[model samples]
Target: MPQRTNNGFGLVRRGLAPALALAFTLALALMFMAESAQAASLSSSRADRRAARNEAKTQAEEVPLTPETFSHKLVLDGQAGSVLSFTLPEAVHKGLELTTFQDLCVFDADGTPVPFQLRAPQGTNQRLEVEKELPYFMWQPEKPGAGTPGTMDIEINAKGGIVRIKGQTDDLAKPGPVSYLLDMQAFFDAASSPVSRGGLAFADDDLRERAIKVLLAGDEPFMVSVTMKTSADLDSWTSIGRPQMLVRTRQGDVTLERDTLVLPGTAKRYLLLQFADSDVPIFSFAARAVFDKTTHEVRETIVPGTLSENKRQIGYTLPGRFPVTAIGFDLAQAEMMAVRLSGADDPEKPYAQRASGFIYRLERDGVTVTGEPFPVTQSNRYWRLSAAGDIPFAAAPGMRVYWQPRELLFLARGKGPWTLAFGRQTAVQASALPMLGQSDVQTAREIASPPTDTGATTPAVAKKEESREWVLWAVLILAVVFLSGVTVWLVRSMKK
Candidate 1:
């Protein structure tokens, strides 16, 4: 009976082997199912992302001027003082080129339009790893001042028994208004010597009033003309000058100050006394000058140029397709010349006349006193000397183009691959292609993940999902193996 019972137990244990084996196999199958499902889901998600990115690229509207199919060059004489112009072909805007590239060409000997390759300005194209958006303001059309920012005039009334002198002060900056009281009774007592009383100090001997200033009260308009002298050491004095003030107004408007006597020398501190033909009581008066507040913000950017010392002419070219509203040079001396911009749309009628006037700088006693600011306006390219003359170019004459850059629009079409072609013509062509596919994408800053409603998948999210799948597969594999080993051991023990 005992042997029979043992055989029954053995039989039962033997049956358990197949059952355990089946269980192990089923566990493996389930793991495989999990892996398959994860893979399918990942693949579907990736496909959706790709489709969305492609669609966004197709609809991308804000594209910069592609250098590959747009830019061109012309052959014209960049004479020192002769007008040159190049008009763009109207055919460029006929197609979707404006949204892609604009075609520009120059005429050959037979007036046949010959297209030239595009060359981008050096260091113009760049891609950063982080997203960058800069905010800038556009300039509204500003009406310039009628004359200058600030004006000063001296008026003398000798016939009215009282010398009534008046002044208008628009310049309220430092070195502005300096007032002094001149007692006529004390002038006679000094016996033609230096007087220093009542905020007024000056030498009466050989003393020429370098400048006379008048103060304007509320609604009291006055204009005065007075000879002024300026001295650095109070021993040497020079005459005031009638030169243009090369400076902007307080509102940041650039214009020339005309018919004004500029102070001599660079002395911040000086003394002033009025010069009168008669014993007139020039008792109390004030003076002032204006400085631009915009100088600190809208500073000048010097365009690249090459100067020839032999020819005394500066060869300069404004880089890129960006238009400049104002084009001028930093002048070292007073000069007179003309400027021109060249175009090629109409070969017979090709140049726009810009300036045919004097560029003046004020100097007193061979020292820089003051000057007029450069005129600012016009959107032009290929500007050169419009008149015919050989003015010696100053050493290191900086050619600067002042322009308020237009604000740009960058469409956030998710992040993947983007291609940008710039630099020399050949390089641009080699890297250029129709805006399609993931073949050549620029390394721009990773765009932020779109809103959840857009059903967008960011790179970060995809990587995280893959990691979770790997972890789940590993955990399931280890659990199955562990359970299978335990089942096998328990069955063997039952058989024993």
Candidate 2:
């Protein structure tokens, strides 16, 4: 009976090992399932947010600014020293934050540009009492200000400059009361004789600034009036500026100068030039088409360079793959040069001339400007330049990159609450107007819980997600192997 009891106890002990191993394996499987479900939940949330952002981006609305869309046009009587206040409508106040004075335009009744200084937005104003309001024109009589009471129009337009491309042209022969300065100078020998009159038509109506290049011969001094006109169709003409007088006379034997035309900033397809009857022969007339410069946030990047065997070739590797706009060089020696860009890591690859152009350097009046700023067509990680001379290593060379940021402003037409979504290129979930203000704009460490998880996920979050999946699988696999070994041991012990 005692022997039988001992055998029974041994059997029980042998069975206990397998039972505990099976129990341990079951717990590991359950934990893995829980972890897998959690990972899936996070992934699903990310996908939903990404899909939402894509849908929102596809349906963005754009509003074209025109006179027809103005909510109100205020016409006010103006004088030289008049103190005018403009009270912004409720819509403008709620939508925009007036950060600078470059957000408005003032014009006169005759469509002439009226220049006025933006009165600083003050905290205390007894006049209009509007919280987000600014004092209107601080008029000056000498400039583009109203000398007397007249009609004034205000509009919402940002202050920006027009791109002016100037070139000299000798193509000034027309059926007008004008003769070339060369002809007049040869005939009369009067160094002061200006070109009688001339007319040259622009290829397009976008002309912003026009100037006649004047080259004076000898110490001849004379005054001449210049008249300009514009025609949209080349048939009908409208006078640009009243005949303005220009004088050219000095002790120097020769002089080269430019007389700019004060034309209004408007579009005109054809331009006519009339020179005041002086004996001075005109050199050339230059006209620049006015194009509004696009304002963008610029970022600068530095790239180190290595001089090649020939020493004239400088090779560099760009740090990032960002689209490059301009390549800058801090030259120890200034020389005329051109740059070639490529993506090849090989040093032997010959330079291509796909986007190559002349580099310019000018130093006058103690100011020096040198650069070759060109738009990039394709992205390249490598760059080589064959300068007129060898690029000195001591001079630091770099690259200026302009990134087209992945951001945009959308104006939704419909009333009430609006939502936005974007970004499938990454784990970041989505975006919206109001949600962006809280999550993106406000730098709070903790975001107001994302609406539907549209915002993007950080790289750290994504890495942890991947690690969790691997860890869960690893635990399950290890539990299975351990349990199988324990079962084998228990069976062997029971048989013994």
Candidate 3:
């Protein structure tokens, strides 16, 4: 019996050895298959990503513009030889896919694309020159508590003239025509005029006209009339006729201020200002000179927004992708509230704060004063308004957005009745071409044409790619299942 058992054990051990070797061989084959499948999948994914990047890079140059690919079309009228320029209307905002209008295309009657350039509205250029915080010395009557003629002793020589005026130690406490002498020597020196050295040739034409802006700090609102005089020589002064009024008054939340006084013509080296009203109790004042010159012209468009609201804030959805210049609110009732304005290009993205200020509509004594529109230069599709505090709105206010539409300058290539096509998700961006000079271009009139919407086209290439991926996955799955089944069968046979 012992001999028979030993023979059976030897036969079992011999069978087990062959089964283990076969199982090990099968395991190695399975691992190699899995590795090959994984490597292929990774390579395919990498290739797809690289192809996508390459397509995006060249799409602007390779893709041709077609009428059927866009959702909106407008007909343009101009001669073939002339370069045409047109300002994009607010209606085009709804069909814009890119903030920079890269998706916009112009095609002639024969469907051939034309070279175009986008630009801001052309206008007469203007520049503002400001001289902030001009230096001034206060002067008062020479004799204290006595009615006497004010004496100004001036010493004049070749280099410069210096004026010495005697007055009380506390000149601000006295009540009279408070005088201030403004030294314009620095302004003359910077203007590069001979007048600074007392040669007396007029300054540059750009600095001929100037406006003085004054900021007053006082406890109460006051209105006063001022007399201005200019002098090259301290002894001989020329009076500017007519007293200008400076006023500051507040009613409720609205403050009305008029502190700027326009000068007649070119100013001299010295400026003297005399206040007429003494009972107003003037405390302190600051002044600046502003020079404005027309530089270029600007064109803008204002569009009304569709209002929306949530539990936290109110929003305005603009129809077009606009480079917002300013935001205004139309309040039906007289109300004042501090609010913050925010904007975003996409609704899914967080709104960024653009501007924050108090907006008010106040009425008093049969006059209404509305706050100026908040100035903000941003490009966005959606805007939101939130209260600075927990202030609630009784009713929804109207919103108006102001933006300067980019001008499109295109060569009138091919034939008549050119079309502007826009609004496509997969369409390639149009390259910006060199724009012709304004003098060389003719203005093109836009004819309102109903946009044709050929519904979204299905991408056959994407569908084919997806099908290929599915086939590769199925083949990998089948190989894994076959290897697993074969391994299981071998284990069962070994056991038997």
Best by lDDT: 3
Top-down TM-score ranking: 3, 2, 1
> For residue 129, what is the lDDT in candidate 2?
9
Could you tell me how far off, in angstroms, the CA of residue 293 lies in candidate 2 after the best superposition?
A: 5.1
Which pairs clash (backbone N, Cα, C closer than 3 Å) in model 3? 93-320, 123-296, 123-297, 124-295, 124-296, 124-297, 125-295, 125-296, 126-295, 126-296
Q: What's the number of clashes in each of the models?
A: 33, 18, 10
User: Best candidate per TM-score, number?
Assistant: 3
Model 2 CA deviation exceeding 4 Å by range: 1-294, 343-352, 360-362, 388-396, 408-496
Worst 10 residues of 2 by lDDT: 125-134
Tens-digit lDDT string for candidate 3 (1-496): 3455545556557676776677668767766776686677667767876776566546634656676667778888987867899887766766887677766788989998887877877764333354545666566655543322222444333655334444435546466667767666655555453222222233355454466667666647888899888887675677876789988899998888888787666568777777765555444443343333433333354444443453336777777677677888888899898889998988899999999998789998989888888988887878888878776765667786767777888888889788988776554445566655678889998765555554634222222345555676676667667766776676566556
- For candidate 2, lDDT tens digit of each residue in 341-376? 444434477545435665556676878878656666
All candidates' lDDT scores?
A: 0.36, 0.40, 0.68
User: What order do you get sorting by lDDT, best first?
Assistant: 3, 2, 1
Flag the better candidate by lDDT, 1 or 2: 2
